[model samples]
Target: MSKYHSFNSEKNIKYKLPNEITLFWNKGLFDSFIGIDKVNIHYAQFIQEQVECPTIVIVPGRCESYLKYQELSFDLYQQGYNIFIIDHRGQGLSGRMLLNVNKGYVTKFQDYVDDLRYFIENIVTPKSSEKPYLLAHSMGGTIATRFMQDSPNAIKAAVISSPMLGFYSGLLPKSIAKILVAIKLKFNNIISNTPWYFLGQKDYSPVNFTDNKLTHSIPRYQYFVDLYKKNKIIQLGGVTTHWLAQSIAAQKELFSKIVQLKTPILLLQASGDTVVCQQAQDDFCQQLHTLQPQSCPNGVPSNIDNAFHELFFETDDLRNKAITQSLAWFEQHT
Candidate 1:
């Protein structure tokens, strides 16, 4: 176990994964399902024996594996809900697409939706007749949104935290970033004949805690850092030009097809997020509200002040509040 697993009080915050949660994770069922193109999609589930409860399907963010969600799974299970998390293909424990395993690439964004559909139809529903709720984060939010649009009635309710409706172009304008991605993608097609990493993108490398932009809790961040270090197979590098292109195209489609969504979804915005564009999340809610008032309620996200990109992995205060709100939303529809 890493030193981060030990509870500590610092700066008026306490963070630790309890032994019982670890035991619960140890009992989890880790498995994989065949997705489109025969890509192996890894997933984890924690179901109470002979206990019927509404399931929570967790779609994680980009570069995330189901291993990173053990604490989260345990937390939700303790709340009387079964938890299910999937490691999207080309990342995590799932099958990689390119020979260079570090490079993140996807054939298309729809493949992600199709994989989730296959998983729910073949694996989740057959085991549990109750319709599952959705808890998707970051890039997973984007994939889950598309999934909801494609299969409107698939899930009961959804909680999308810091969704990747748009990318945060660091130090560059969004237009310039799109142009650069387009140029690089064209160059790769005409010259490289292989996927090229986006500018400044590289293989997985651990960054110092002080420099990370994902979360505010040092212990929580350190735990995942150590986890990736020990489990190199789940360490994924930065995005490829192809993956970025697919994501951009998917965002466009998501906005264009906003009216197709029927599942009720709660968009949780992180006020301090620098990973995805907050404006895009707002626009998505606004548009969704116009189409279906019941889906978004108002034209705005339930903002979590001072929270970072990874809401669930944030400090106890932020993480607990988000989970509580999500559970409340699930309970309402149940």
Candidate 2:
């Protein structure tokens, strides 16, 4: 384990390191030998105190870097849990899939799921003695649910933070969006590649803290902004039509399979969230509640009053509350 006494404590970053820790990142090429294509994937791990602890794998939201999660991981570590996080393809420090790194693009959603499975099977499962727990945020939550649907035994329990079970499609209805996407997919055949943006989406222009809907804590929010500013690899622009279509399809499929999920899961609903549909979360949790309550293979839902999409980056009180609630949920099913 890479031992660390502090996380640049002298510099006064958001949170100070509290334990002997190891931090390392894996920079690997996508070799067909492993069947991961040519895409490069970035992964980071944090081991705390050399203690016998259960592993917790975090899948961050779209356009997010694992570096944005350092404080949360530190808090989890203080509670005696090991950490592993992945920066998905086409985003973060991972290799970009398109000529325009700022534009989000993916051939299909299954590729993302496969990549996560590869990471778990090869990187996490062998190193840790305990079955890892999953904690997914936004798009990560969508991918995590899909992963659980296919491989339920991979993780002991999971906590989804404001998962994208449903999207805030805004003025566009589902029928219209699907029809538009179908048209774009058809256009793909005529053109080499379709470059249609999602409605009025644009490139990565830094949103001032006041206009941002992500988090309430300006300081914590700015901390990540600085990280993105330092590295263009961690920055992503507007969503493409293909990504929007894939997100809709993935969430639709995952919700359909909600009744069959045997994994113990908790859906953390953000009461003040505008990014994803809270009604969709309630719908899935309602179905999960039908199977079991406070038990394995059950989908439990909790609302964090006055919270936003980025619960982990919220105000200190709210952030700590989320971290505390998550630890409690993980322990319940562990």
Candidate 3:
């Protein structure tokens, strides 16, 4: 094990941007995923005083950018881990796919994995520690799981928070929604590329706190809302039909290869999460245990009872518990 100097939480609890925490960005990532597009991805890192530190790469969810993960990055930095956060293509300050920048769009699910791989291979892996962990949430978790299945050695461990292994389709059944989407993809010329929005979905509209399912803390929730209200460049709205179909298919591919993954992946399931399907998580973790009994004796998913969909974005107490458990799980695997 590497000599990781743990942070003194009591002393370092007051969130200060210490000199050790430095930020950097990378641009002009040329991606050949769809017709040789040059997609720019921005990334930031927090360095500590140590010569070699354990690293954690933060992959933000749908409609999210690295800007929102500043607090989480700082907290992780205080915990003796260097942080690397990236805003994937189409989100954040990266190039948008369509005229309506708010529309969540992707050529295919693999396009995301390709872009992530580009960031890792060209940017992160070169400067990061020998062993790095992935901390991904929601849609980000879905992407990460696919990445792990394809490239198992990319990270030492992964904390998949409220993973979109299968998304909650509100009033509609999952199978029915998927079938409708599949049919819509055929006749629509721009369906797979630049397409119409999902039903009842549109450009960015701020959701009121009363209807919010993210966090229990008002200040934190408002902080994110205010962020989007201020920086429209990072404000991504509802999903497009192309994105939904790709997400559904990618999730199917991920679970198919879940048992083959060698890296330690912890499915951080939230008991109160209404955004994702908990039953899917249960099924995936159970299969992992059955296939790899040695590595996953009791399965890797950990249920945080009081937590919501956004574990890191939740109340301070909930966030702290999730982070503590996540860090411990990573360390044990390391």
Candidate 4:
């Protein structure tokens, strides 16, 4: 009926119906597609068989892919919420490096917002036709926050886990960092060639760190390890100056009008998160309490203790607690 549909038909681009895993995981019934920028965008949806249930879209942090959130999807599915997830451009099984720049590097934060907007307009709404909920973690939280500010009525509610409002590291002054990144972006589109520091840690391997012991025992991590190992291009090493500048801009925008967001928000900050600054979380909640009383009526923010940056990947106790708190928040709001 639409020109895009005819174009897709001409290209033999038909939606591939998902299998049992899709139904069990509550993933939407579509596969990946190349977006307007010629970058591959992978997305999946889940639909309820009987009663219509609210949808929850899961957005992962940096260096994360759809495979990593299978557990989270399973949990949400059990809670009777359909789920949709997308692999950000250049990350996961999506398209690899563009313009010789590494995956996960973007010239502007709007790139992510655009990718999300496409997913929602083309995939989520068409499949579900219901108001969706957002569940974003870490770097994804930053992106989700910006999306909420940009499109207030796009979704009904949002749950942010250990959002990257600011990082815990006290490296360079914020002003100096912005200037350095701007110069790098001007010189070369590709910069910040250093590997992520956490990758060097012996125990930090995805194989060794899974929330589910039973699943982790079965060589599950090896699958992801092999995926990245075979496709070296998908391995986004570290953030570049341009990426940092984009992140700073997004953060500024998020903080500028966070209290004015009409969508109900559940900000989940990790007490033991060593990556994102906890003080920023406190400040954000305080501001929300003052400005948007309806969104956060109680004046007390919801927080979880003994959790780190990757709260979803924490040990069973912590991960379960995070999931419980998240579902409870969603139930309360939705």
| Candidate achieving the largest TM-score | 1
Task: Determine the backbone clash count of candidate 2.
Answer: 0
lDDT of 4 by residue, 1-334 (tens): 1211111110121122124334565434658877747778887666677667788999878777776666567667767778888888757667754444343466467788788888877778776657888999888888888888878888878888888887554576756656665666665645345322221222123335445321212233344456566656456555655566677788888899775578777787767667777777777777877777755446544666666666665555666666777776677776
List where candidate 2 sits over 4 angstroms from the true fold. Answer: 1-35, 292-300
Q: Considering lDDT, where higher is better, how would the candidates rank from best to worst? A: 1, 2, 3, 4
True lDDT of residue 66, candidate 4? 77
Kindly report which residue stretches of model 4 are placed more than 4 angstroms away from their true locations once superposed: 1-30, 97-103, 171-176, 179-234, 296-301
* 1-334 per-residue lDDT for model 3 (tens digits): 1243343232232333234432322221222222217666667666667978888888888888887776677668767877877777788877787899999998788888877777677667877767688999998988887888788778888888898988877789988988888877664655344588877789989999889988886777777788788898998889887788888889889887876688777778889989889888888888877776633338757888888899887776677778887887887876
Better of 3 and 4 by lDDT: 3
324, model 2: CA deviation in Å?
A: 0.7
RMSD of each: 4.1, 4.8, 4.5, 9.7
Order of models, best TM-score first? 1, 3, 2, 4
- Clash number for each model: 0, 0, 0, 6
Against the true structure, what is each candidate's TM-score? 0.94, 0.87, 0.87, 0.77
Error of 2 at 250 (Å): 0.8
For candidate 4, the TM-score is: 0.77
Clashing pairs in 1: none
Cα distance off (Å), candidate 2, residue 206: 0.8
For model 1, how does the per-residue alpha-carbon lDDT over 106-168 read when each residue is reduced to its tens digit?
Answer: 999899989988988888887775999999999999999999999988899999999999999
Which stretches of model 3 miss by more than 4 angstroms?
1-36, 190-193, 294-297
Model 2 TM-score, all chains together:
0.87
What overall lDDT goes with each candidate model? 0.87, 0.77, 0.76, 0.66
